[model samples]
Target: MLDLWFSEFHAPDAKLSILVKEQLYSEQTPFQKIDFFDSETFGKFFTLDGLIMITEKDEFIYHEMISNVPMAVNPDIKKVLIIGGGDGGTAREVCRFKTVEQVDMVEIDERVVRLCQKYFPQTACALDNDPRINLIFGDGLKFVQDAPEGAYDLILVDSTDPLGPGEGLFTTEFYRNCYRALNDKGILINQHESPYYKEYAYEMRRAHKKLASVFSIATVYQFYMPTYSSGHWLFGFASKGLDPVKDADFKRWSEFGLQNRYYNPGVHLGAFALPNYVQEELQKED
Candidate 1:
């Protein structure tokens, strides 16, 4: 008998291994390596540059949380800019809001989108079907920089880690440009890394600090993602005026009649009530 396993190292001492039924595809793109696999527990899953990006069984959690949280805060959001969501999961969720009129998705790697479209249609479904979506294969940092001031009502930075192609997305200049590109009442939600591990904690704090410095209202919210570096994950929320907790239009959002697997009005409120340690970590200097 032969056993095949795919593993990822989160840190020097932390590792995650998954039993693989088969390796479906593998490629080395101009930007990074992409691989897809099938497994008993996760179904179809994909990785980039040796890191797990998403798995079918739990992909809903990350996509729903990132898209719905800000949408719930301002149910009237019509224009959106999605940075680095090449997989289209974020766009799929955002397009659910009939209130939304337009969406711009920018990805550094075109191959990630094309490959996901071919092999992982579960997440890449909306890329071609949604009329409101404008797909751009380009640099997210430059997209924000050249964006007209007050252009978008919301921006979802569903990016990879602050490494390789995604490194520039974490810069102070990028956050500043994001601030400038958002309308007066616009919101920005970004992948805020993790707080459960020391390596990711620094990125969490650094991202939070930079976002806080850029926006009048800024905070981080939590979610549990089983396969990420840690089960505990976060998203940075920043806006010109809306307070995610205070301004959350739960009743209005409920009117959208969207049933989600991991997000609800109650969970939305609780996600912001950060753990004491995470709060402390966000406050500390980088």
Candidate 2:
């Protein structure tokens, strides 16, 4: 019997490891290193540059939280822009609403999308079959910067951490471009990193700060993702004027009669109620 393991370093002193049944695939793309593994506990999962991107068992939590939050806020979102969600989970979640007419998914690396389509079909199901989804392999920052004014009703930034290719998406200029690319009431939901680790916490606050500086309403909501650092993760919600908790049209959202594995009306509101410490963290600078 042999022992094979995979590890992601959260910090100098902390890490998460999963025992591997097999390494399904490994490749170094122009952007990052991508790997797929199978484990008994987590089922199947993948990583980029040795960082866990998503796992089969817990991916629904993140994809639904990011897509459904903004949808519940404005269920009538007809046109959408997704930045960096190469897995297609976010697109799959968003396209569930028949109201969405066009979905432009801009992923920098086509390899991520292609591999996920091969290995993670459950999440990638909508990537090809959906008529509304248009796959564009390009830089997210430039995509938004060049977007027509008031072009999209929702812009979802399901990106990697604030480094390498993903670093540009966190900039003040990028956020401002997203705002400019959106309709008057459009919403921006981004991958706000975790709050548990000192490194990720800095990213969380920095992202929120830049968002606040650009949008009329910028706030973060929490969800628990077991595979991610600390099992606690966040998604940044920003809009021209909509408050996620206050403006969420639960009544309208319920009309869809969608059954979700993770998100619901109550969970929607509760996600916005940040813990005291996280609230303090977001408010610390000002």
Candidate 3:
């Protein structure tokens, strides 16, 4: 079935139900009871699973951070793989880097991709016209496992939080596959859970512990995702020999000749500098 069928069928009614019901599932963290808002360009801004921003108007922040940071750090990064960014926001950000030659987006939900392209055209713009991008509508973990090792220069996991559908993405097996998928000096960055939340921190620690064994360099970063209950986020970076943090080749933020709200060269370096407790917990070896 075409995703347009579902989008046309659901339209605004489904979002209305989410607004009125206000009953958030345990698997979901509700950023807002009325998180789904209407936009002039996108029509409706739907917050999925309460962790991602799915709007046409403003999807840059999330995309920029996830894609640019690792790209900036590894200036030679050419081929990149994105796992689970069905909305295409991350693709848009990846394309912004002139150094990047190719990008592959592996998304499990064709529905989400179609709806995002239809509604959030701004975020999905590059995915439509960019010649360097490949859209693979399938399972990401399986795709990585089947792929040849050392094929990617950088891998960005832009999936949702590990609540329901996104749970397996945060596991050790997935991380191992990511390690195998990268080139000798390839870098990987994934959205780690929240630091303020105990369990989320613990989850990050567990993943970090697993990642450390495979990659020579492994570290977690922090950022503020206001919609989240903790208003803070952690992302793990791992590399075979590239000391994920120290090898940053950010000459300047203007290298891309694009305008950004949250990230500049300073903010780029600063975001990776974690606090004492975060350092202690996530760095602990199992």
Candidate 4:
């Protein structure tokens, strides 16, 4: 009887829309506005501050790329710190590794975690069941600042865009603290914004420059997230000693026998091969 649609603007001049079957839930958390919806094509999905965060259809791509690439580089990674991955998809992927001894997830908004557990159990299922996971509700920036030096082997910044609650997580100081919080062989993975749009590309370059200055090895890898602004997105891989490509042990990673929908040993190497335009943009003097 009625047609419903959910829409997001990729750019001021461009927008993407999904046919909504129903609006399942809505809430205004202290940190941001959150909404969950059921769509005809994407199935169930959620948004924060009107921006799409996760859709049931293609979430595996984002979660897999962020977690597995770093793990492949260093299978021995034991301690992990995840900053702002409230939906728990990133945590689920990280917890799959038997070698990871501990996982500390710092989500600024508790509501995001609770709501995802209620509405998107597929992603949030591992939040409580995993004995290795320590869920903390607070500022992610401060969490890293207060953490003892060399506390974590891997730090994954699964933050929203460089705005609102997630703004501080993108700062140079935050990344500097992440560098200090990690061990000598630790790795840092961040949701480096998309490169197809001007606004996102600016933030991408800014994040890259800051990380490059803080870590001995800083590089970006690409992935496709259909719900995100442009189906194209990136993750920054930074570390004091490990180079994701040069040090990635494909043979050892394959031995783990992990079944993934999007990530694998070969895809691990291919994701780092950025397009010529993107490479040139990162190389530009800022």
Per-prediction TM-score to the true structure, in the order listed: 0.98, 0.98, 0.81, 0.98
Regions more than 4 Å wrong, model 1: none
Scored against the true structure, residue 51 in model 1 reaches a CA lDDT of 91
Q: What's the CA error at residue 132 for candidate 2, in Å?
A: 0.4
Predicted candidate 4 versus true structure: per-residue lDDT over 120-236, tens digit per residue: 999999997999999999999998999999999999999999999999988899999999999999999999998898888888999999999998899999987888878889999
| TM-score, prediction 2 | 0.98
> How many clashing residue pairs, candidate 4?
0
lDDT of 1 by residue, 151-197 (tens): 99999999989998888899889999999999988999999999988
Residue 147 alpha-carbon offset, candidate 2, angstroms: 0.5
lDDT measured at residue 191 in model 2 versus the true structure, 0 to 100: 91
How large is the C-alpha RMSD of every model relative to the true structure?
Answer: 0.9, 1.0, 7.7, 0.9
TM-score of 3: 0.81
Error of 2 at 160 (Å): 0.4
Off by over 4 Å in 2: none
Candidate 3 — what's its lDDT? Answer: 0.72
lDDT of 3 by residue, 15-75 (tens): 1221222222222222212134453443456566443355444455667788777877777
Q: Cα deviation of 235 in candidate 1 (Å)? A: 0.4
lDDT of 4: 0.92
Identify the superior model by TM-score, candidate 2 or candidate 3: 2
Worst 10 residues of 1 by lDDT: 1-10
Estimate every model's Cα lDDT from 0 to 1: 0.93, 0.92, 0.72, 0.92
Clashing pairs in 3: none
